[model samples]
Target: MTTSPLAASTVTADMVWIPGGTYLMGADDQYPEEAPAHPVTVPGFWIDRHPVTNRDFDDFVRATGYRTLAERTPERGAPGAAAALHVPGSAVFVAPDPSAGAHLDDLSRWWRYVPGADWRHPGGPGSSAAAIPDHPVVHLAWADVAAFAMLTGKHVPTEAEWEFAARGGLDGATYAWGEEFTADGVHLANTWQGEFPVENTAADGFVGTSPVGVFPPNGHGLYDMIGNVWEWTADWYAGHEPPRGCCAVRDPRGGHQAGSRDAAHPEDPVPRKVLKGGSHLCAPNYCRRYRPAARMPHAVDTSTSNLGFRCVVRPGHPAEGDRAATG
Candidate 1:
């Protein structure tokens, strides 16, 4: 076992040292994709205490003058491109009225590609990330995360690493904190209280992303590990095919890039990546994915309102010194 810096107080204020350990990577009870609950081990690494916020991302943008994927207009003749994909925009969740007879099957009823919907203007035209600077930054594609990670000398956590940290030393528990979604009648994370895509009660005091650290931290002092927003993982989207006769598959990445392509549309070979920690849009009636083991496959080119990311810095990484000196 690697010695944990967490005990030595070497952890930075903005990050937490997740001790290396073995844990069950997925859950068998919930969601078909996250099945065959298997054992995996990950090395200890430093993870952001919370999801990267708008203020944090804004600083990155200001420093590097980087433009997120959403800000760039799509090429005209791209394969499997939407008819209206010429504009620079990102997907935004606009809840329709319950009386409108919006079927849950058709996600288009709620999700619409809004022009000018980037990290700066999360809700399309009039809205601004400035209004919720403390909230986790949204409307980021995989490339955006890549750019941010590169600039900061950090890495996007792999699926195994992410799941391990999210578990917060809780080996096989269902949720991040515990088995109960709401422990002791207290809302632990920012999740949809009522029906999703139609009505949100804001019971957790938020309809969208809540300010990071507003909710209680998990066992590892990591906040928003379960909800607030879905976080990007480095691993590709694939089934949980753990190595047979496991010796605790160390740091198992998901499916390979070629196999991660969306099977639904074979014509478009755009690969999907794993997204963990279901977002604020998750609800009981819709997506009950606010659990630590829950996983979602997202296209690399797509950016949504409820998707964001955090980064990690493993020990012995070349950028480790740089991160410490800068942070």
Candidate 2:
């Protein structure tokens, strides 16, 4: 969580270590809740080589005067129910004119949701940041990324610190860099290439959200984690708990699933809270769930613009304990 030099000059003060080994965390065969694929390890840390922009959350809401929860509170169901149903605030996709042959199962016909939007009105209220202040800093949650990682001392990386910084030191690669979704074809990772909802041939040049670090930086140099928006972790959405069923990894990793409003519509009761990397409306022809064992619970009252967050520094605390790892 040293990431403070904000004002987005492409926000790269550079850190991205991520050495840590032993992977194969979960899901190798199209989601049965990422069955069987286990194994762990994780040690070395230090991430955020990118992501957490919008002038570094507007200098962390102007040096901790902070407000974002969509500027306090409003999204509580109906009358703009958090920017239209379960929230998707500041939304503004619309990119549909590949000769008008579009699709994406009515992503609200093209995303919309807007309500004075957040991340300082990303695509709403006449959008500002003066010109994409290097994007990536949407409407954060997950306790406002643990209160901006305790106001920059750092803390918020847990889901095993976001799957050990998205398994960037690769192991059972589905993509954190490996197992080829395309190499000679060149479409490394930004997802939704085309026909996922109908037509997205922007071909990774841009459709929305893609300014974090442009792309290419995993093997632990973490950048964009897995597609743009959808960061937030420090865990807590519990469902189908296993693999030592969780609890005790140390440092912010506190979650193990249990907030099932529908756990895949187990009859839709309306639960929420659980959102990891996988945004820019991920479209592997139908919400590829944004791997890292794919998850999406969402409901800690709700708020969106694709969701956002990033921060962590608990290796030993105070001044980041010489880069954390102290027990």
List, residue by residue over 200-297, the lDDT tens digit for candidate 2. 67677876677777877676677778877887665556553345655322333434344445465576544455566687668876788666667666
Off by over 4 Å in 2: 1-24, 31-38, 41-59, 64-92, 102-118, 124-151, 156-159, 164-229, 232-276, 283-287, 290-307, 310-315, 321-327
Among the numbered candidates, top lDDT falls to 1
Question: Worst lDDT window (10 residues) for model 2?
Answer: 318-327
**TM match of model 1 to true structure:** 0.91
Give the whole-model CA lDDT for all candidates, comma-separated: 0.83, 0.61
What's the lDDT for candidate 1? Answer: 0.83
lDDT, model 2: 0.61
Candidate 1 lDDT tens digits, 83-103: 565888888999887998647
Model 1: residues with Cα > 4 Å off, grouped in runs:
1-12, 77-82, 263-267, 320-327
Candidate 2 TM-score, true structure as reference: 0.33
